[model samples]
Target chain A: MRFTLADSRLLRESVNIISELVTEVTFKVSKSGIDLLAIDPANVAMVDFKLTPAAFTEFETEKDMDLSVNLENLKAILKRSKPEDTIIVSLDKDKNRLTIDLTGSGKRTFNLSLIDYDREQQKLPNLKFNAKITVPASKLDDAIADMGIVSDSVALIASNTNFTMKAEGNLSDAKVDFPACDDTVISLGKEEEVMAKYAIEYLAKMARGSKLADEVSLSFANDYPLRVEYNVQGKLHLGFVLAPRVSND
Target chain B: MRFTLADSRLLRESVNIISELVTEVTFKVSKSGIDLLAIDPANVAMVDFKLTPAAFTEFETEKDMDLSVNLENLKAILKRSKPEDTIIVSLDKDKNRLTIDLTGSGKRTFNLSLIDYDREQQKLPNLKFNAKITVPASKLDDAIADMGIVSDSVALIASNTNFTMKAEGNLSDAKVDFPACDDTVISLGKEEEVMAKYAIEYLAKMARGSKLADEVSLSFANDYPLRVEYNVQGKLHLGFVLAPRVSND
Candidate 1:
């Protein structure tokens, strides 16, 4: 398999978002696109990622392949990428190495050793949602980070007229509230009232997807797992499923 | 004692640099200026700092006062200062608390608890140097960081012709060299030969003082202590003295 991207964002940002949850993941690539489904070690969060052929300037494959690679090594190399660099990817079957090249003013290549993980493929849990809200990515990311300053968990609430993110600590409390008509709210869900509590640490990690897109789409229900998705239209889609925290209130 | 600065850079950057060497330091405040002279517990380095009345838009001190405060707590409050914020500092003598107010979009105040520390005053050692070089702060800071990547210590070499910073690791080596004619060198010393080696970690801490000014001044001699100074004339003076490493070379 070989692929060349005009830029590294589709690849770099995806790795950043996924690596926060899992260290190693299998990339199933075919003519359609590259897909990754991974559940973190503690099984509290799962990442669903897709990079279509459109994300790259050029893409080719023999048929289909499954490659399990360490995200840490890949992230280190990606960290070297400047905004001007383009990325090219290939595989060395004999050495079981994933070869990556960043091309710009200079050419830099890295050979990452591939690990053998013959574990069964992960299947995403089937989840349904009753409410969906799409808001600027910073709105959600900043709110999650703000809540982290006050408590370990954040309560997410959505109603026909508003959405609220609230957290309370022993000595401090923080809240981010937006009415349906607020200019920052592109779309507000009308599900009467839906509420769920999620671990702020995981939510904050998942919210980093904001770096990949201008807006984030969130879908959740009362006491149900939340699905956060970041999509750059024809290029890539990065989604996360976070299990809700059981709350007495 | 009471003082208000137009911005926090003079205070913030000084605290950041000094805190890396000492957790606590006494600030000697007088009509002239506020001065701090501290040696790290390890005795490997000393920070000599001064924030003159020119740095503050308002300054008032009836008598000389020596106040000891935890640098860590002061640093935490400084971290919250924004570029548009003006910092006002005053002492609550009865409560032994340092009250700092940040005024900009809104007003925020932090009263940090003070601890009683009565360490004897430290006097800076007097040393004459045959070499003195003033270069752009980044030219020196970036070189120090580059050297840090290769070794635990960096060797500084200077002659009438050129100056060099070099480091060697088991497999890699890095060097930054500049001749007397280099434009980055505001003034290169004309010394036959003056060389010294210092712990890179301590040097790195002292290099952070560069944040206070565009240029950093260096003075040293063969096998002698190194003095690094960052001065925004009329505003503040932040200097560090780092003991040289015992190198066979």
Candidate 2:
């Protein structure tokens, strides 16, 4: 299997976000593109990532393949890709390794040994969300950052007309409000006022998906796992499902 | 003493560079502005910094004062300064604290407790250099960074015609050459060829002075301490003197 991306930003961005939650993952590659589903070691969150053929200038694979890898190693190599460089990834079956080539002003190639795969990929959870909010990913990132400044856990409250993220500390607190009428608020809906608390650390890591897509959809329910999704049209999709920090808070 | 800089960049940049070398320092403030001379805990390097009255918009002081502070604390406060903000530093003698005021879109004040000081400031070293080479600070910074990738020590070579910085590892080595005719070589002079080695860690920290000034002057002799200096006209000066890593290498 081999693939080349004219711009490695989507690969870099998505991999970076996922690597923050799990150190190792298996990317199931086929003719359609690549897909990966993995749960964090702590079982506090799960990540779902997919890249379609449209994201790559050239993609070729003979058959379905599971390329298990240490994400940190792949992320470190991908970080070396310059804006003008085209990134190529290929499987070296003879050596049981994966090779990354950055081609442009200079061609630098790095080979990373593949890891053994014994665990099953996480299955998709059928979640029934009571509320869904769509807004600019940057807005969500900013809210998470603001909450991080005050506390380790943040409360997300969504209603028919507005969304609010709030965090409190021993001496300080921060809040970000997004009214449905705001230009950046693409959409908002809720069966009732739904509020849930999530660890800011996970939200901060998941918010990094903003680099791949401008708009993000947030789906949640009262004291239930929250799903945050960022999609770049048909090119790629990166999403995370995070367990709430509290129960019926 | 109290002073306000239209842009806090000079203070922020110089202090940040100095903080990397030493954790604690004493700033001598008077009508002339501020002066600081401190030696790192390892005593492998010394940092000398100065900010003339020309760098500040409003300067006022009735008497000279020695303000001893933790560089890390001061750096944390100054890091909050925005480009559009004016930074005002004032001494709160009654409370034995220093107040930093950042005024712009919002007003924020941070008070840092002053440290007790009984030790004398480091005296400037007096040594005549056999050679001196001046080049763009960015070029010098890049050289130092490249050398850092190969080894923990770097050698500096200077002659009447060109300057070179080289570093060698067990398997890899890197060198940067700057000819006298190079556009960025502001000046170069030497009675004879001279070379000296210094710890790259110190050189990397000193190269950060480039943030305050684009041009840097390097002076050293065989097995002698190296002086890296950056000056922003009448605004400020930040420099470091690093001891040789090996004698006559």
Candidate 3:
């Protein structure tokens, strides 16, 4: 399979986001679409990544392929590729190595040995989320940053009227509240109140890639992993599902 | 007696940088230019800021003004001002309250009470720097970040041939070396070799504000405070002289 993007930076950014919560990513590519899945064991956070052929800037595939690789290693190699680079990926027959070609102002190649990264993909339950909101990434970033200074985990409370992130710790006792009607809030919809706590460390990582998106879509259920999804360009869909940290109090 | 800025963000950022290094800032404005000087007790560090009317995106001042303010409070208030907000600062009759009018999307006024933050503004000696070089901020940031992981101090060695930053400890040893002729070197003008050990914490703090400059000029002599200067916007110049820490060998 071969694909060409306007820039490799786009793909690098998406990988940077997914690496935060998910360590091993399995991508199944077919004629119809590409599907990616992964989960964080302790947090039980998962990501369901999907992209259609139409979303690809360029796609050329002759057969189906399923591959799982360390997202960290993939990120490191991708980061070496400049944004202006054209990227090409192909499976080395014997298929032991995954060869990635980055050609732009310079030529570079990286080969990573694939491993048995497959795990029993658990079926995520369909649950009703009481709140849904699209908030500017920057504002969310600030709130997350502020909360991160105080606590490893942050509680997100969402109602029809407002969104709040709160953390209490020795370093700081802070709360960031944004009204649903505030300019920072792109959209806020709710059927009821929803609250979940997740590791602020991971949330901050996921938010990094969403900066270009006007807003991020968040779905939360009490005690369950939070779902974050956003589109980067029409071609990329980056999502994260982080398991709620059991609150001490 | 008064001045206006096209945007408050610049002032906020500048004040933030100064406050991070020193507690107070005094601006001695004259017909020739404005001189800003700050000193940290224990003589660990000091900042010397110089700006002329041409430095302001816009400038209007009739008489000389000498004012000292609690930079900590000023930074806190400036942080609340929107980036695009127009900031108007004027001296009040009581000479205690500095009226700050921030108007753009909305009008908000702040009365900042001045403080008696007095320190002798010493004319720093013109030390014979054995070495000097203009290195990109990002490169220095990367090195300092790595060094920070291991120790509180970093040893810098600069010569006509190379520039290196190293930190050694039980956790790990980190070093970033850039050959004098390396492509990353923006410029190299040095007379002799210079090497000194200084606190990494202060270097990191000083480098934080340097994102605005393409390169920062560093001058050093044996066992003296490291002098860091960044020419911002071709007009506003910020300088920091940090006393070297004597670490137990």
Candidate 4:
């Protein structure tokens, strides 16, 4: 398998988001695109990522294959790349190595050994949600960070008129209200008021995808896992599902 | 003592440079300015910093005083300041605390307790040097960082024609040369060739002052400690003396 990317930033951003949740992942490569579905070790979050051939300047595949990758090692290699660098990735099947070539001011190639893991692939869960909200990615990221200063968990509440993120600690509490008429709220739908508490750490990790897109879509039900999706330049899509924290209150 | 700074960045930068060498420092405050002379625990380096009353927008002092400070604690408080924020510092001598007020979007104050150290003040050594080189601070910083990738110690060589920094490791070696004609070298003065090896870690710490000044003056003898001086905006002067490493060659 061989592929070339015109811009290396998308891959870097995708890997950054994935690394936040899991250290290792398996990539499914086909003629159409590359796909990844991984659940974190704690089983608290799931990541679904896809990059189409259009995302790359060139794409070639002899046959479909699953390759296990260490996200940290890949991130280290990607960190060496410049913004204008073009990246070429090819697999040496016989040698069980992946060769990554970065071309910019100079051309450098890194050979990373492949790892074989005997683990079953995670299947995406089917769930129904009562509320959905689309907002600017930065707004959500800021709210999450701000609320994080007050509490370890944040409550997401969606009503007919507004959506709010609230966090309360022993001495401090923060709340960010997003009304339906606010410019930050692209769309908000709810049949009734739905509220759920989620771990701030997981939400912050998911928010790392904000680097990939200007807007993010969020969907969830009352007391259910939250779903976050970021569409990158119409070519790549990154999604995360985080289990809600079971609160006593 | 009371003082207000138009911008807090200068103080922050000064503390950053000092903290790189010593965790604890003593600040001598008087009507003229604030002064600090500290030697690192390892006795390998010394930092001398002075900020005149001209550097502060408002300066007031009733009497001369020496205050022992924990640099890391002070740095943590400074890191919260925004570029546009005005900082006000006042001493509560009766309470043995220093109150720092940051006024920007909002007003936040932090009161740090003063520590009493029984250590005596360190006297600056009177030494003579045979060579002096003036160069861009960033140029030297880059050269040090680049050479750091190759070895733990670097050799500084100064001749009438050029100044060079070289580092050699077991497998790799790197060298950066700044001839008299190079833009990075403002001036080079030496009657004869002089070379000395110094610990790269200490040099890197001193290079933190590069952020405060465009150019830095380096002076040393054939086998003596190196002196680094950074004059900031003609108002603050930061200097460091680093002991040379004993080399077998």
Candidate 5:
């Protein structure tokens, strides 16, 4: 299996995001471009990520590799990679080992044994998102931070005129409002009215993951699992699905 | 009163570090340059910071200004400043407040009232360091991180041959390692050896503070306070003197 990326930083960034939610990642590579799907237990959320050949620095894999390994260990090894480095990933089925080679300025390779991770067979419902918006990564990050200042859960609403995140905590109150009244960048197209509440902790983790990716594609339906997708690198996609926060009152 | 920095980030960084130890900061600017001295209560630590006009991006002040305000509040405002922002700090003596205006992509200012803060009178000692090495920031950062992996306190020993950090924990095991073996970039001009144990927690804080500045001047005498001095944006020379932890055994 061989994958090439122009900027090794992009691939590393995508890997960084998906690795956060799942320890083991499954890569489905074919002519239609590469696809990645990751889901945590409970099936309340799932991330479906995709990347076209244009985004890949290089893509030369004919077969698929559903490799699973400890994410924290991989992250530690990846931390040493330089931005200009060319990353080469290879798996030896006979040795049950995954090798990551970083080639650039200096050469470094990390080899780790792969574990038999049972890909969950749970069926993910065909999600019907009422709202979808392509907002900048920094805006979402700032909104999430303001949410953290207020409460453990944040209610997000995306409308035609504005996008708002509101949190009510015990002592402090915080709300991030992005009105289309001024900035021409953020726009809410038709059929974009969706309101949902999610655990601020999970959203925060997702935000951290999103920071490395260019822009996050948010999909949500009222009280349903929210889907966040990251178009990582040119050949990879990382996605996260999080359960909505249930309110008592 | 006016002072400018090559990088606004450096100014923001210096304020971030000074705010951690001292709540209020008194910057006494003179015709010669700028000298800032702050001493925390308990008389255990003091910061003596100085900067000359040549290093300043812009220095236009015929007279001196003894401006004192809450360092944390000032830091909070500086945090919002952009790296390219031209920070303008002024005194509104009639209003009894200090205003910091950051003008870059946008304009923002924070006005904080002056407060009376009692500072300890600390007499800095002139001690000759037996060991001195101008090591890279990355090398020092790595050494501190490695030592922290084993124990809470690390004893630094610098000699002509090597710069070593050794730590012994409550457990039977210990670690002694030098992050950099033999680098020509690291200068050991004086054939000297000095060993002093400092709490890893404080060392880590100092290391973090050192990140804002290029290199820190470390001064120490056995059983005495360890001093770290670094210039920030050539406008602030922040200093830190930490007391040594006494060994119970």
Candidate 6:
């Protein structure tokens, strides 16, 4: 399998977000695109990432293949790429390595050894969410960072008229409220007012996708895992599901 | 003692450079300016940093005093400052703390506890140098960074017609030469060619001062320690002395 990306920013961004949760992931490549579904080691979070052929300038594959990759190693190689660089990725079956070449002002190549992963692929869970909210990615990211400054966990509350993120600490408490009429709120729905708490660390890692997308969609049911997604129209899609942290109070 | 700086970039830059070599330093504050001279624990490098009253927008001091501080803590506070923020630094003698307030869109203050450093003050050494070269700080910084990619140490050679920096590793070698007529070479003087090798790590830290100065001056004699100096006209001055690494060859 071989593919070339005119802009590698999206690929790098997606890999960075997933690598923070899972160190190793199996990338399934086919004529359609590249897909990765992975659950973090602690089983507290899951990531669903997909890149279609439309997202790449040139993509080709003789046969479908599963390539187990060390996400950290791939991220390191991608970090060396410049904004104008075009990245080419190919599998070296004989050497059992993946070759990546970045071409821009200069061409730099990195050969990374592939690993054999034995874990079963994680299947996406079918979830029925009561509340869904779509907002600007920057707004969500900033809210999460503000909450992080106050506490290690934040509670997301969705009501008929508003959505809010709140965090409380020993010395400070922060809350960001977004009404349905707010420009940042693209859409909002609620069967009933729903509230759930999640670890801020995971949310922050997922929020990194804000750099790639202008808006993010969030969906969740009362006390259920939260789904954060960034979709670039028809080009690419990245989503993460984080488990709720049960609060004693 | 109290002072307000129109811009905090210089202070942040100075603290960052000093923290890389020493964790703690004693800052001597007087009516004229603030001065610091300290040697690393390994005695491989020494830093002499001074900021004149002219560097600050408002400066006032009732008496001269010595404030020992943890550079890491200070750096963390400075990292929070925005580019347009006005930095106000004041000593809380009653609490034995340093209060740094950054005022801009919003005011944020950090109260850092002062430590009692017991090390003896490092005095500046007076030595005659046979060669001196003044060049654009960016030019020198780029050369050192490029050399660092290939070797652990770099050789500085000053000749009558050219000044050069060279580094060699097992697989690769890099050299940057500046002819006397080059715009980067502000000035070069030498009775004979003088060469010395120093650890790249320390040189890289010193090079960080480039962000605060347009040009940097280098002075050394034979195999003696190299002195890297950044003088911002009359506002601020930062200098570093790095002992040469003895070559086995």
| Residue-by-residue lDDT tens digits, candidate 2, A74-130 | 999999999999999898999999989999998999999999977964697999888
Error of 4 at B210 (Å): 1.4
Better of 4 and 5 by lDDT: 4
* lDDT of candidate 5 over B77-104, digit per residue (tens): 5665566778676666796766555565
What's model 3's TM-score?
0.54
Docking class of 6: incorrect
After the best TM-score superposition of candidate 4, give how far the Cα of residue A31 lies from its true spot, in angstroms: 38
In terms of docking quality, model 5 is incorrect
Candidate 4 residue pairs in backbone clash: none
Chain B TM-score by candidate, in order shown: 0.94, 0.95, 0.90, 0.96, 0.82, 0.95
* lDDT, residue B178, candidate 4: 85
User: What fraction of the true interface does each of the listed models get right, in terms of native contacts kept?
Assistant: 0.00, 0.00, 0.00, 0.00, 0.00, 0.00
DockQ of each two-chain model: 0.04, 0.04, 0.05, 0.03, 0.04, 0.04
Please list the C-alpha lDDT of all candidates, in the order they appear.
Answer: 0.83, 0.84, 0.72, 0.85, 0.65, 0.86
Model 1 chain A worst lDDT window (10 residues): A182-191
Give the runs in model 4 whose Cα sits over 4 Å from its true position. A1-249, B182-191
Candidate No. with top DockQ: 3
DockQ of 4: 0.03
| Candidate 6 lDDT, B1-249, residue by residue in tens | 899999898899899889999998899999889999999989999999999999999999999999888887677667767799899999888978877777764345556677878886569888677788888899889999999999999999888778999999999999999887756553444356888899999999999888999989998877889899999979999999988887664
lDDT of 1 by residue, B1-249 (tens): 789988887789889888989997899999989999999999999989998899899999999998888887677667767788898888888977677777764345566656778998789999887678777887888999999899999988887768899899999999998777645453334557888899999999888877888888888887889999989977888898989887884
Of candidates 4 and 1, the better by DockQ: 1
- The TM-score of candidate 4 is 0.55
lDDT of 1 at B183: 55
Error of 6 at B138 (Å): 1.3
Clashing pairs in 5: A4-A58, A6-A57, A46-A241, A55-A234, A56-A234
Q: Give per-residue CA lDDT, model 6, range A1-249, as digits (tens).
A: 789999999999888888999998999999889999999999999999999999999999998899999999999999999999999999999999999999999999999999999796579999878788888897788678767765799899888778888776543345667777655452334355888999999999999899889989899877889999999978899999999998774
